[model samples]
Target: MTNKIDLDFLRVTHLRGPNIWTYRPVIEVVIDLGTLEEAPSDKIPGLYERLVAWLPGLVVHRCGVGEHGGFLERLREGTWAGHILEHVVLELQNLAGMKTGFGKTRGVGQHGIYKMAFRTRDEHVGRAALAAGRELLRAAIADLPFDLATHVEALRELVDEHCLGPSTAHIVEAATERRIPALRLTDGNLVQLGHGAAQRRIWTAETDRTSAIAESIASDKDLTKSMLAACGIPVPEGALVRSADEAWDEAQDIGLPVVLKPYDGNHGRGVSLNLVTEEDVRAAYELASRKGDSSSVIVERFITGDEHRILVVGKHVVAVARGESLWVVGDGVSDIIALVDSQINTDPRRGSGEDAPLNALAPQHGAEIILELQRQGLTAYSVPLAGQKVLIQPNGNVAHDVTDRIHPSVAHAAALAARVVGLDIAGVDLVCEDISRPLDEQRGAVIEVNASPGLLAHLKPAEGPPRPVGKAIIAHLFEDGEHGRIPLVGITGTLGTSLIARLVGCLVSLTGAQVGVASGQGLYLNQRQVAAGDCTGWDAGQRLLINRTLTTAVFESNARRILAEGLAYDKCQVGIVTDVEGAAGLAEFYIHDADGVASVVRTQVDVILPHGTAVLNAEIDAVAEMAALCDGQVIFYAADADHPRLLAQRAAGQRSVFVRDGAIVLGDGAHEQVLLALAALKPTTASWPTSVLAAVAAAWALDVEPTILAAGLRTFDAAATASKRA
Candidate 1:
């Protein structure tokens, strides 16, 4: 029998090539879910027809439905099949057209095809796409095996008897959102008040879970300062003050030469310094009051020093910008107003539709200038006796020239400040004359601290974009084995779904760690769950969503789409954890050479792949079943002996592997295009369990040594310990 078939990705490889099927036909669908207003015509009956008709393969046999049956089994495995994936399938109709209220709801709509589509696209988009796609697919696939028929009937009978759904939340979610058949009861003729899960998934950790991360953030001034103090860093003497009255009292105690600011403020706002005269103090109070209603002001002894912002991540201080806010630097020709304009204009974050630097405060005034020059006993116009090393407070805010001076002590203090806060990432704001000087002797103080500091600052910030900083961070975040990050592969989509749960389960199990789940962005981002798209969204949060920007933003529900595309970039020397099709998983690392072409490195992918994958796909089932037969990480059964798939394609690869791992190369000259004598086993049980994985990831993050780590991983009995606790 001659039958046409398309390639469903068995093992990951480069884009389009020959298929495994001898005569099996291909199935394809095209669609646009971005637009949806009308419902469908027919339901399940029509859906089956549309799907089979469009499929390129001949109808071999019809797989009928049943609970825990082979059809569902095949469908689950189908996700790994690599065919061109689509977000929606307008070409097909929903199976048994989903049943609904007296009015029929379109059965399953586009999601039926989407289940497999994510897998297809994950494979097609290559590694980067797959990494993201795999995460998205995990989230999307949770909709299956809809409300059970028997359960729906039981629910309906209960509704009729009680005239009210079950008291618990689950019944409400089933009755309303699932639109499970409900008998309309006359509650003195009141409306039906049933509900469904507020959302299908809640991937966020609890309030306490998030609070820990915030503590390390600059959002809490007490924590920030405490951390710096722990590091034995020097700063102007300061204390957190609660009420305006406390601030006033403290400011008085601080006397005239003091700075009052919000304890947890950043970006140079809510700050007032150099109240040399009473007018400046009053204006400063007004600014502080305007900053916020819950404005907890900071009272500190202001030192006669220069200010600097030192960027640090882990043990490294990425960049140091000599302290300069818009106010201090001057153009000898331009007036203070013009000089302010020039400075603000150059600041991309500040100038473009942002609060101007000096609407309420001035960078340089007659008294300030005279004071700066007077300290040298001169005036602004006083020719500084041929570069008399004049010290300008705001004057130090020039374009950073770290090549000149960054005292080792200041760098040490900045790193200490970040460490004190118990954060792996931070930016230390400093006020110092010359970094080379001793902390006590230097006329400087740590002005502020930043958490999740902007990557832009470390790049070629206008003046440069913190590109190098980003590179360093990206490297550390995705570095392989110990001495690096615990590869964090974010899997989101219509997130909050089963895949997230499964992937989380899989990752924690493999790494032998606790599910170290943390929420991204803020409470707002967490509450909404899935980040939806713009324009006519059902909810208001959609309207204000950061949405997808070219910079560090998750696309509007399109993270799935991007993950689908990024599949190929998964190639790495260490380890990777992308889907059979390539997409996002590993963090993105960029390498730019003379061509200025930035090649994003996706690595440490092994962390994402689950243990039981062998039980799924037909091909992998066999290979994973015969684990001893497979040798090395990249055991491809390619078309030729000379080149494995990736090598034959001549693709450029990168290094990745978030935590500790064994490095292996595929398609080398000595071992190209060959099946291994002993296959690697696909895991049935975790080498390490969840808590162990977490411990390992944490240990890797802290750069624990291999011998120590292996001993720890070996000694850690996550399964037994967890079971015992349970």
Candidate 2:
């Protein structure tokens, strides 16, 4: 939580073996907190840790850049070094501050980001830091000393005076100036400002194509009824009853066995079922009437039949589950005390953190049980007869409590319900005895839907066995097209909105693949339309799209479009959306409705972006992280001299090429060179452009054979030209 930033977080050493280390020039960082000065050789705390862990096989600087007298000094000499330094600086800026949410937010800062990173640097790091950082930033926003407008002015002043570094301070200035709220990340990746941050929660191939999941559509039971009606889902005739009397009135018309529950509640809360009489109806209605402030209550006919939760995220159906009728097994030998204790410990209430097993439906008690036991010729203290199964009616105080042993059909229903709710990740609740039966059975009903489903109950397993529901959630939400088969060569850009259609076309032509241009327009294009387009919109218009997708040369237009989608979906797999991060007059449409509904919406037109000036004010490292999102082998082309920074960062990860001539040449040296290689692509394998000569020379020193290197240089001349012609 400290405001002062650490500067010596540098000194990356490339690791090749157990003990061997090699040095690549690295850009170092030194925060000169003049007042909090340190001795000349003060070893930074987390700096050495990063070097030891993250740079295991990659090249790193021997002498870290240091801080002197309140300023980071001694910028590195090589293009690679400067690029790496800039990356660290931008991270520090996020550490120092950057607005949370999508890139469109106003400020830079997140909460408690540093704490988790300090805890783990490996797999647990990114998601942990992102979760905490955003939370911290979301909270800090309301308590800012001055307005966002005022903060921006101050940040600008700080940058103009060089008080803050160019890449990081500029972020503070940008976020503040824009009024989107910002936070500078500190150690552990803490969001230094704001609260309730919502960013980086999505990064996947399935769903989330347009960022539509984050936005919530609001409505009451009436809205639910309407949506169901439109989707043509079978629904029992019902009305929104605001009061117990109205509920009873509505229930009367619908006959016996009614159900009452909240209109906007998630999970299985505030609901009552199997009420057959006027008295039963009154109790259920009263309970539902005490709804949460953010929700509403509804009374309706409780259909007698089997139910299923069908979940569809984007385009894929994730899971389905059948609700089981609630029942408690009797050990016959154990006292009620042991039974209740054992059950409550199963799948406990929400946020209670304590596992509540028997407590799920309704915790058993001595008082209520005495009556039932007496009827069975036994008292609470008396041992139950062997092999006896007790069915307890949920009087106002109790309801179906156990969902841990649900039927497979119920699981299927849960997935279906998630799909029905239009969320990539969701949980559905069904109340039924025989899950495998058809949904029209007279003993089951679908209760509610949850957008973010938790499977702790299924995980710990209250009863028979444990299910990997959590893993299923991960798969449903994260898994993309079959990884090994897709062969997606991701292309990125800083100004991709300006070149999306062309980029796709270029890729298709180069790979001898096919395009899905019409898919973005809502058309389920066959192989026919993909080959028919002129490749116009796919060319320059997606500058905004590719950048946000991976930011090789992204533009603002693409950033805005993705942000506007709110969340991604699985359906985008075959869709060809473009110009994200850009604003169109209307919102970019996503496949949210069912297949029947979606078919009517898609027409496959080229995406258009709002025009704007290009902005390239981000730190190199930030851009590199964006590039890594491509998640595929990609070829980066750049003439602008700034794109190669992506290559340097990407080098640690995938098979990304620094394209110049027809043949690929490994790029080394400075950030500037990396940028140049990524940006320029007239697609000509021209006269041995010495532009890559310096990098080639560095490779020669690294022991690459001179003859092979020379041949590489020669190959680009003809290959690049041939690529251009193609």
Candidate 3:
């Protein structure tokens, strides 16, 4: 019997934000390769070849060698199981269509134990991938039969079920490219795109500005057509009908070859096109009624042209996708189902998931396909003669890009249709013989105006180039030179950081802005203590960020929270570090010395925006040294006016906060302003001068007026603040 190597998973942690690893979410797994510790990949017989056979995509991983096939080179030259596991998990996720590459493996100073981390878009999918990767690797090492295809399929299903759909991710990625921060608000596509009061919300293609009334009008097809026709935009004549008799009557009145569809249907569901017979019309009416929210159906004059979906954002049309009929040629050996599977579904663009540009047609499941086959006296099980072309679907395959070919008048008509329906973002379905010609010239007509339309067709069209629909949507939500960020301050240190956060929040609130403070004292919205406990962690900080009413936010963090969970916010307008102090209880995190503590705390400085400022205590050399690491300007604060770092910074025309002649002073090299007399604030701030100075410097960086700062300082109740912390 072969002795199987034992690889045990010690722990798996999902860091949901920027952490010590990188500036994105990653899954950290601690693995103990007990007996296999002595057996590297080269030592394990047949392991390297088996892994390569299973996951050939691992060749792209650069690993430590930093080039293509570097991981394979490592496998040949000998490497640890943990390192192999990292590459395997990443490859599995890539094959499952998530496309993540960042990963690392580090030793924890223990024999046979290592921590491996890899980037993942969703935590649930990451955990599942890790488990599958572990099992696959173990099977390969043991020379056990493992079905790689089954595992990959399972991972793909998990990804489809949990991760953000492709359309939502595209929009979020575009927002990130614009330096706008995004927070997923649900397991679904709902996302918030900025911080606090400056934020905007989006759910797939729809934005917060998408009016409820507009969406209602867009859903009702008859109403939408009426509104468009009234606005002088060309629309197909349509009338709502209640039953099969009424549907046929309306179709006859509109003339033969009319289209029958649900009155409030979406995604082409329950829609049958170009029916010239009474039997086909009645059957389509039944199908439409079953698919719609109500029993109502619409019969419209079938416009003689290929179907097109025009995407409109704000005041302009951004993208256009033209549809084509789907057909399959039989070889005389297979039925319609087999032909579709072999010919059409075999296209790489077709899939059952949202990632696919076009949806795979399942004859057994699709009612429309069944009905279409019945129209041609063909069933899914019927076999056609050799060289016979059978129509599987007419229209609804709107994945071919025609944006550049669209005439300006047609674009304007689509945009006007969206405006008539009151949609900020709309998908206008128009049928025209040629997109390059004007709609009036070709007798093209707008058939439907849709809200929250699927964007994947434009993002990854089967033909032509993919459009920047996601960028267009984001641009529509946020104006030029706006990233949707509110004024934010983050404070990190051991010495009275909570007091510093509270003071900053109070001073900012005096500027007539609603403030949210997350600190050790508790979670505060303005002056109200909503939750009383240790609120200095990532969860606490997120509460402040997601609050729509909050105009300004202050967060208090420490070395332990920074090491365990990342800072709550992505970037701050002002970052304050009062002191590095020490890593007393952080031995568990492997942070032993002051240097380790300094590295952890400096994360606060690392996240300052380019136009922001960092407030550092000049007394602590470790804290003051972090000034150079900031992307923005730095403000030094100390009780002593003669502090060298403060003095040098002031000399260079930079800002500094210090005490002079019994008063707190805000100074540049060329000018100085006395903020307040220390005697007036002695009752509240004298006990913790360092914290007070840090807060004042942070407020100054936030552009708070000196008089309001003094008022906030004098009115602060040190006793009440201390009690809250307790």
Candidate 4:
């Protein structure tokens, strides 16, 4: 066998939190480049040219040069296999329809081994991209034929199976725009926005606030109609029928030209409208009865009006969409189904997926369309006479926006119907001749109130401006200024992060808040260690943030953790960077100097919320320099109160903590408060004083009282012992 190029994946880790990568989940892959280590892109014959020809879109990757076409420039300039792999994987995921924009590749101590990380919206897609990227790169390097289309097709399939459906993604995008953090609770659309006690969960268009009782009521169409009618919302006069014969009898009683539908069916499935004959009524009932939870059908008076869907969110009308009846005019040569494909289904808005505003009309959808065609005395295979108009769909597909034109009274009735059905957010289906006229004037009535309604119609209307339904949903879920986040603290450094995190947790707990800590020692909850061993990584931090009982949390982030996985949380209320002693362990990540270590550790300060605070070690010049990078307030801690960095913060009328004589001094420019004597703090280690100072500053920034801080410092040892016992 000819020598084969190998890019062996030694390990793969899914970091499901903010890490050294961007502020999203990413996959960290450890790969041994093997023979490829000796072959940079420029050194290998035709490798760069072949890769460019395969994935020319990779030129958009800005890389370190920070502009378009930068990755290609780097490739042409002789970048190694690790960096190339990062770009290839990202491009593959992008081409597969799951767009991801952040990536990084760095040395991992071993000569040929490197760590590559890229943003991953879906774990399965990320893994597939990595595998495909490896094969594609190997093929390109060896001048072997690679099926790029097939590889991309497989990754696209994974994306469709694994990523969020469009409805949930829109809401999540709105939440993200509001700066509210989100975490996927499952492999599907179930997502939790915010963290801990402040979280609100959403599954597609439905929310945690969507009542189960209301959903049940909405699902029972007959009950919903009764409820709406009782509330004076003008529901259609309908009766639930148990059999096809009963359906015809009910239709006769409702009078000629009646509607037949499943009692519990949604999305217009198994519904047949405007049947004047007994035969048509019985056929419609047979079609409707087999679809819902119960085989029960509802027969109602058919109102002569277009159907309109009114979206109600929290007692107000948020959107309105008017349905247009679907019809296909037959040509001389085409059958009915073929005519539908060429005419009705040809609309750009019609599609088979949720992203499509209107669903594609196909005879295979069963019952409704087939029966409608039969009513017209034609089968799907029948090619009607030229110029013949065959009705394909009588209602549903409310794809035309009419929100601005809806009469105030009609809007009020729609909201009332939703309220009567007990839905916090609902879609109220009403049939009316003129949406701008009063419901009473048009003889219009609310026909159905649906729970967990599809938002696609309003989000992607065919003829009018798309509505901001996602914003309305978010507003209903959370109030103004509420992003669903609990107070959080992040402590990062080589020397004192673990101790500082522990002390900060202790101080926060004294406020009667349930506090969680992820430290070098273990993960602690309420001063009790729940998990043993090192718990300062991204996984450990995620545990604390995901816990519902945690009202406040503190996490320790070290250089190794930062380089390997990234910071666990997205942003923090208080970010503390203790002394950056040296670049000791960072040799693995290619950091040989203090500046390189500072850049890695500064990621902690980068995530401080604009309204939050960053606590820096003034004793270390590099740590103090990170203060300027913080988006929030800066508080410096030092052994000496007169240290230049501490004095600078004091001069700027900012907060600082330092030792003044034998006592810990809390200073705010020309003002100083003596909190506790250094002798009072029972030190656990040589670096204990600095840790104590950093923790106090961070707690103070979080608005903890000085007495609580003093009490926590004094009792720190017993708490440690208690944590160990637990």
Candidate 5:
């Protein structure tokens, strides 16, 4: 009809876990690039220049050539629209503040049909980026104007809405660095780290170990102060007052300069500092009382010094941030509000977003700022003379890192304050003349003990280097040498994988651990079927790993599942491959032979933990070839004890499981042990010698005792398991 190019999305799938593409969550979109399939970038006038001009970050995308400016090289040489779309989507996401680098595009055997995938932290954001990328690419191809800023802003809104907050993400990143798997428990910040019984849950800065009573005590400022005072930790003298009159009376009783705030408040909201007059104190009381559900306000002596926040994790002070009073130097033309906008809010670190280290200041919008202005005999509209200084905020922007300058005694007081309040992780707010000097020497005091404190200030400090507060919190949750992982086994193959998984599950359960099995037969938790009918995919595996009562887990996957959904867990203690035999239902995925199946099946071995083991069937040449792909130890299994691969594995000082006469044998190079007789196994396993050998190898890798392995095999009932699922 015309020379116009067009693209139609055929399908979009969110691969939530590892897949054939990679070991991360990716959004895969199948597109039909109608006429654009023939229109390579080099053939399209101004297309390459337009794209590079809009997304200059695309030059860093190594793409297929695997070097800087590789994507640009491909575009200049000649490339299809689908490949260009992949890079565009990734660049869009990067500009939207979610940095991800992995992407791929390939033809689907059809003339114009192609599949494109890119890594994303959130699926919703990924889909939004895809839609925007498609529109932008089409507009560029048609030589039409596209508003890149509007699209980037929309994608950024989606990122803020769907992605984890910076604090939670920092903690999750730390956990990932330690090889601890994390699962988001909610759409919000609630997340679970580790697997099954070893897992710990965190919501932002708070963890499962944070006590309800401790949080309650921290919320009540008066009680927290009293407790700190009693524990010999210096605390501000404060009293709760009910009415505005009572607030002034308490302030007078305390002294001329006083601090008034809500009895239970956070984030410095509804707080007035350094009040010397009854008018200011009474007005501050009304502002403070309106903040929280409480009507009472606290009147305390104003400790004259810079405000400081010390982060305490366990018994150690991990990070410290100092707050400086905000001031504006008048240029003689701008009012207070205009000055705040031009001087304070204009700082790149200040914004309304969670990623911003400091919040933008607006005197007109904040009650505390308005009250502070009133005390200074000024309002938001007041303009000072040139070079004259006006204090806009007296306190409460604790974002300059002072951790290295904090005195040891001050650090101890903060840690002790947190301990006194009974919080495993806390932010202790204090005021002192100098952080390098002790608090007692400067008449400084612990003003508040805050539970679930904000971590942004320490993580992205305005002045000093960012602190590892997230790592400190993670370390408090998990000790050294503990990754918060339980023993896990993953089985993948085309034959007898379900049975092997179930057998291994049963064997591990004999050690008094509650084992969960997700296999083709069904999903079993401690031998009880929780779900039935082919539970050998990512979702079922996730259920097992997330179950709080599960002490150990076994998962079964086939070549098809590996190609389609990826393994559920990140790594496993034992990965078993029975035989890479079948390619029957994989034609849809373009996998038509055992070699293709072998490549898919090797994903199981590829994910084995370095300290873990891979149990391979030495009988199958394809499966035996994957032993070298394992990052961990290998245990070859076969029906014949003298199988050459098994003998070689044994000679290499590795483990092997095989059948010798009528007995199952376990050998480690020079030593051999008869674990049990084949006659001792249940009748159901009599014709499943290979499956039995695979199961025995996996169980041995998991450190199941020889005696327990024998007993579990003798008692395992396939009929009962199937009936239970039924």
Candidate 6:
């Protein structure tokens, strides 16, 4: 009992996309529980109590029992360390602000060793959380002290650095909901949705359709204002100024209570609002100059009202968020900094990171705040009299959702302003006394048009319901009937999978589409080899997916690849299983028996798109069994038309491909058409029944004409023979 419990990770693999476990990225860890395997939660005195005390959020995990407090019940009833670790790891990630719930634990046949997988948004954060969870769990088990808050804070910082920012993640999540696959192009916000030539990239709210010219236009405030005014859209009068003297002159010309800010600056940086004094305008000009690379600053008439941000996507206003000024009441006992902290930062929605809707108020972060305080004759150390209200920020905290209350005319004007600025997606900042009233009636005017606008306000608003701005942006990027996918084919089995994959690629290429293939021979682009030596892996498949010139892709999957790394692609339009020739040479992955081999091979069928088809070899009983697992249509293929599964498929008015009278016959129930004579096919392909039949079935599923498929088969046979001879 005095011995310290230890956990060791034997292996760690990051499944980048959909895998056998689930349809998302996951960190699969194989861990050696060592002596801890003998000890369950209930056996370790006070372990359950300690875990519940540390992570009370475990109550919401509707575990196997499927209700509130189900996991806690399991903890009390005695669960193994592997199961406990799964829940603990997930809970740690949740506490760290990267919420996730999917996890699984399975025994690896080796004594005291197990495999655990958990959903993860970022690989770095997931690994860090796993290490932290192991240490925290050990401490909890041994009744040792653990700094939970410090660990959680570090994890949150990691999330901020490694994971996608809120706006980009929101859009990615929306794309996922629409069943569009996505790949993070970099560690930052650059993300690709869909695959190959059909993919669209986005960095936050700016999509592939977002114009660089529009971004430049939005950056120039004076030009943007003029464009809106010229297009009959309400826009505030503004003038660019060079020096403090000119800023004061512009303020006077526009009348008192003018707003001063950098011409190209965004996110309310270096902005001074409702200024009536020359001294304030002069000081603000100095701050504005530092924010912009250019020396120019803009001074405009300050409209009297709450500030609002309207999100426009593809000529439509999708969301509106209103902003309010912040104030702190003097407690008389505390200084300005302490009073601001105790009053304003006390709100849970305010934090130092972008995850929080409202930013924590700190004097050091902004000179504008200090200047505002000085205008009221108070510094960070100054203590105000009791009951005195001091203004902190005059604007820029747009966190109130007002989408439902937006006046039609106001929404129209916002969309028009975005169009005038030439942005496909934009954030329009306008001032209005009442958003429910028309702009002309309320003297409302668009003050700023911003490209790559922050979407946090609408996504996680401080007040009112959250808006579906992510969905709007996704709709704008991909119009109706576009899933952002190119044609993809997958082949799996022990016999002739690589050859079948190449043949399918050849048939797809005959249609004039650029085809990319990854198989045992090599990675090929339209018959040109790009990489050599066993290219049937995740890395080779990823290259094809990311290639912008590839219109079609074919991948070869084997049992070893499935057990070790999972499939390379997310899902496939056509999945072909030539035959289950039996599991051999896979003992290294702990897949020893026939059942295990069948399970591993079924991963291919599991990924078939519902609208697509699965071409199964009816001759192999194990492969024939996979037809039931496909989410889409099934096309049975065998050498004999009398094969039971093939006969059943044809009887059920389904498609089947077989050989009859020395010819390949494609049959749909009562109708049968002879595609090509077996003798006419090249000697190499005709000799392999699994390869030729599977290729023909897959090509038929891809809608390649029979004549073209015949030509592709002949061409592939000649090339494959040449490769072997060479």
TM-score, candidate number 5: 0.96
Tens digits of per-residue lDDT for model 2 on 316-378? Answer: 443443334433556877764455446433534422322222243223443333333444455
Winner by TM-score between candidate 4 and candidate 2: 4
Which pairs clash in model 3? none
Alpha-carbon lDDT, every model: 0.35, 0.34, 0.90, 0.86, 0.89, 0.87
The digit string of per-residue lDDT tens for model 4 on 387-413 reads: 988888887668899999999999989
Per-residue lDDT of 333 in model 5? 88
Once superposed on the true structure, which residue ranges of model 4 sit more than 4 Å away at CA?
1-13, 28-88, 104-117, 137-145, 494-496, 581-588, 591-595, 682-687, 723-726
Residue 605 lDDT in candidate 2: 11
TM-scores of all candidate predictions against the true structure: 0.37, 0.37, 0.95, 0.90, 0.96, 0.96
Q: Model 6, stretches more than 4 Å misplaced?
A: 718-726
Per-candidate clashes come to 103, 188, 0, 2, 0, 0
In candidate 3, what are the lDDT values of residues 357-409, reduced to their tens digit?
99999886799999999899899999989999999999868999999999998
Considering TM-score, which of the candidate structures 1 and 6 is the better prediction for this target? 6
Over 560-584, each residue of candidate 6 has an lDDT whose tens digit, in order, gives: 7776777888889999887655566
Q: Which is superior by TM-score, 3 or 5? A: 5
RMSD of each: 22.7, 19.6, 2.4, 3.3, 2.1, 2.3
Candidate 5, residue 715: lDDT: 89
After TM-score superposition, the amount by which residue 320's alpha carbon in candidate 2 deviates from its true location, in angstroms, is 3.6
For candidate 4, the TM-score is 0.90
